[model samples]
Target: MLLKQMTAAALAAALSLFLSGSVTAAAEEHYDVYHYDCWSEAVPSQAGYTAERAVSGQDLGVGNFSEPTDIFRDSHDRFYIVDSGNDRIVVTDAELETVEKVFDTFTMPDGSETALNSPQGVYVAPETELLYIADYDNSRVLISDYDGNVQREITKPDSELFSQELTFLPQKVLADKAGNVYIVLGNITTGAAMFSSDGVFQGYYGANTVQTTPEVIVNHFRKLLSTDEMRSRQARTVPSGITNFDLDDEGFIYTCSQSTSQTQDTVKKLNAAGANLFSSLGVTWGDIRSYYDTNTNTNYQPMICDIEISDDKSINCLDLTTGRVFQYDKEGSLLFIFGSKSDQLGGFTEVTALESCGESIYVVDKRKNTVTVFAETDFGSLVHKATELYNAGYYEEALAPWYQVLQYDGNYVRAYEGIASGLLVKGDYEGSMRYAKLADSNSRYNKAFEGYRQEWLSAHFTQVAIVVILVAAVLTGLHFYRKKHIAKTETAERSEQP
Candidate 1:
């Protein structure tokens, strides 16, 4: 009886240990983290950002979020979540631990009471401390204060520039420092509707240009040759409209377009003139290669649904197609990619919006009715420190951090590039070239080679000069000796002939 009892105890202990180990392994493999190399190949990397926790409205004691479509973080570190299904906006503290306010009803300027009708988007202007809500079903944008007092109600423009046949359905809204409000409509493909602070429709803002492909070029020529009636019968093609946008502190607007076939202008960084500053970079916004699902036998392209620019100018793009977050630097170099479409804790079922605060990223899943918080790991922090220093023209100061990044992720190509740049700035051209080669940065490698050549010449300048001088003196002596010997031989021959 004693032996049987002892065996039972041993089996229980072993079973518990096995279960714990399995859980730890599963947690670590919840999601994959990688970055693209210069060749546009996905390179496995350490997790730069890991899912810390998923926060629901229930967790904050504000009831569960019902189909939250958008999330915005104001300058005051407050978060505003647009609960579309609930027809309200839930405001929370920076940590998302406590509920601050919930906006569902408001008082109109004329002392009339009103309520939000399926508000899809929300933004709080730092300058005016006012809330901008995109009232989807209501066909208007409501500007109100924290107390839910409606200051202005902007509806569809009655001007001829806007088509009267179209319905006024606003999806997203944002205001610039100049108080110019830009709104993304559901049907208008021209661009985001722009309005002045005084509630006057100015015009369209940043508009995407249609991609000129071979098929488009052919269709254009065919239409020109066809008669008016034939041209009218032909199908027309228009540019994909901007789906969402965000504004940075510098007043620059970043827009994202959700399209599977269009890759030209999936993401745009627009200036005040509404010109795309990122066009010249020729960089792909999301995954470089199409993702193939073995289970479904289908290939999926990145459909960027939302974009968030961090304080350090890192662009975090949320891809709805793959439910992955692609984070890039200011120069459009990919830093990290994480998340997936799964029922797992780290994975997102339907990612709708993303926002960055400090070193953490918050992504909202509409179907899941929760916001997953991703906190930067030590590897991510090191990479960010190096990137910040390198971008700020402090290459020498970034060297140590970049090296430390390599210790964590040896396959991190950005770390190699950063190290190469730092080495070049520190006058270690040879080392720079080596690292540049590893990073596949031909331009950096060429520059380093040139610097190395110049340095080598400068170091051996005396030896090179002395060798040139000695060679010249020896040649001159040989010339003189040959001329004298020829003359003496000619004289001896003449004397012998006489």
Candidate 2:
């Protein structure tokens, strides 16, 4: 009996250990959290954000979301989910815990009732408190109030600038601070359709420039040599249209386009004048490396489908092909990368849009009909605190937090860069240079090296000056000695000859 009891206890302990190990392994396998180092190599990293929970329509007391396409959080802290399949908009509270209202029908100004048909996008103007819905199948954008009263309807522009044969299938809509409306249309490569506040067509805005590739260069030469008929028979290459966009507090619009072949202009920060501000940075917006799929036996490149600018100015870009979220600082430096394509809790299927609220990120999955909420981890908070200070020019103040970040993540390249910046500002040039080298920041290292060189020269200036003076005096003495000796020898030779 004693032996039997001991065996049972051992069995129970083994089972417990096995179960715990399985749980830990499962959690780790959910996502591969990593960041690209200065060498463009993938380095393992601590998760900046984790999947806290997933909220569905049923969780919010509304029915299940049917193929939701977009999510927008207004200034009032309410979420407007565009349920495209249901042809309705579901409004929820900040936490997505309670349903506020469901907008299906709206009363027109002339007292006519109309309903949405396959709406794809929705945005709320904070200042005007108006709702902008991109009614896709209806081929129009509707501006309505919270009470479902239509204020205006913007349809396709009848102008030479816009192709008359193409349908105006609005996919996403946003309004600038000046009340100028921009709509992303289906199958239109020109750009987003822009309209004035009063509903007048203002032409397209923020068009992407075509990438110059070797093939394109060859094609250009071929077109030049070919006849007009032959050139017309060839297919015309055009820039990919904008997939989605978000406006920042400063009125800058961030747009993302889904393209696997084109790298340039995949993501753009456009100014009011329609110039890409991020063009000069030359930063890669999504995953730096391609991923191989065993099922398809093919490599998949990053397809950036959506982009969101957090309140703190962190740019969050969503990759459709891999279902990863790449978060970058305001200067386009990548901070963290997480998420994947799976059916697990943290995984996503057909991710369409994302919105950030405070420290949480809400990602909408169309195929799953659910929204996954990711909360910032402690490490993420530390990084953000350090980044905020660093970006604001408080390098010295950010040093401590950056150090703490290194304690958590020794491989964090950004933390090294931050520490180098702080040390540079504090006149620790040598120390700054060391950290800059670790961060792989050549620019920062150059600056630190220059500072160090100047400091060294300044400190040993007197010694160097004395040595230079001594060398000059010795050369002068040698010159006079040689001249005098040569003259004396010549005089002796002449006297001897006489």
Candidate 3:
């Protein structure tokens, strides 16, 4: 009984907290989470690509990479690569050298030792340092630690609850700040999967409506094709070999719908409430080229084969064919483009993954089996960008750059406050309140927000009328109860006198 009482009390306290809207790690209503793409930069050059000691490139001697497909970083800043062709994962220091066997042997869920056929995605939870692998061949997401300790296979959502469709050959697996892993089943036709931090299957999203290259195109290309033509045709379905699946610290998932010759490709974003946000902003590599092509321009031919987000919330897409990396905003605004077709250890060739850790950027090139590091001092400029947008009255636009500022340096309290101001300028009171709390952290905006919120409530609802009616009813109930009790007591006394 005592334990039950304590549990109830605790639950009540939680309910009160929710009602008061004090804490927000969890929310009473739907949480609004948005995702921004970071900038993409080229891997440093090697062949005649000498750095000023400030720059570092990948160095693989003899036993290096066969087909380095993916790269991931653990909490300890250790790098892991899916050396697909070699059927192993390579571990190295911050510099992509000194290859060590992080996981010597890995297998399918059925204990079949057939090797990880094209392991594509690897994710490491910073908290637990547990690594999750999307084993494409085994059709399972293998869970383990950074030290190669095998955990368990993530199962499918129970078939009884939802009718199973197709078996997913997982591709890219990404983790948000909360440690939930989202996987892209290789066959876009099979859709994608989601799992909890502990490897428990959550649910699946999307459908097989993915656009793939038509059978006719593949058949036609099979008949008349040189080596180059064959490669290009094969990539028609997945133009960029890079994983489009990525995350912001917030719980939004950014996955490209399908890469093709279509006028536009959908970038399916699932919000915090599992709402599918449909947009076609950054998925149009072909369209971007057509703009140049239609104008009889040759300079705009896109050779991008990879994409990654920088710390600044802009996309960096590497043109493998051109050896260039382009950064674009959410609305497809080209911020900048760097690099040209260069085949060198430091320059990008067969480049794979790009990740941002504060002011530094990491680009892993599988051909070199190496990771290159670039330190950018211009992150402060990212703050200036947000400030410029805010000043220009583009409050919504400022929100993203402000977020980037905080991501690059959490100590930038001014950026947090700017986010609050931007939200206010956007006329999103609730959103303004959310960031304002974080900006102040001492409930400094409590009075202002409460006053605004109450004013909003009065205008938005029949709250005042409801309160008046409720108060009147409560008073009436108390008066009737007291009168009834006295009458009963008087009746009892009269009966005794008789």
List the global CA lDDT of all models. Answer: 0.91, 0.92, 0.57
User: In model 2, where do residues sit more than 4 Å from their true spots?
Assistant: 1-29, 292-297, 469-498
Q: Per-residue lDDT tens digits of candidate 2, residues 1-498?
A: 999999999999999999999855533536778888778899888888888889998888878999999999999899999999999999999988999999999999999999999999999999999999999999999999999999999998988888899888999999999999999998898789999999999899988877898878888899999999998999797877888899999999999999866888789999879999999998988888788889999989889999999999999999999899999999999988888999998799899999999999999999999999988888889999999999999999999999999998899989999999999999999999999999989999999999999999999999999999999999999999999999999999999996
Model 3, 1-498: lDDT tens digits are: 999999999999999988767533222112111122222222221111111121222354435567677777665667777777666677767665565554646544565543456677787876677677877777777777654546667645564533478566677787677767777765444345667777767766543243345664675576466576666655343332223566645556655433333233334455775554545344444224322344755544444444555445655565444444545544444443343334543366666666655445566666655555644434535754875586566877888888877765554554666777776766666777877776664453564476578768879678778888999999999999999999999999999997
Better of 2 and 3 by lDDT: 2
Across 74-187, the per-residue lDDT of candidate 1 in tens digits comes to 989999999999999999999999999998899999999998899888889999999999999999999999899999999999988999999999999999998889999989
* Candidate 2 positional error at 348, Å: 1.0
Q: How does candidate 1 score on lDDT?
A: 0.91
Model 3 backbone overlap count: 16
Which candidate order results from sorting by TM-score in descending order?
2, 1, 3
Model 1 spans > 4 angstroms off: 1-29, 294-297, 466-498
| Number of clashes recorded per candidate | 0, 0, 16
Kindly indicate the candidate among 2 and 3 with the higher TM-score: 2
lDDT of 3: 0.57
Residue 315, candidate 1: alpha-carbon lDDT: 96
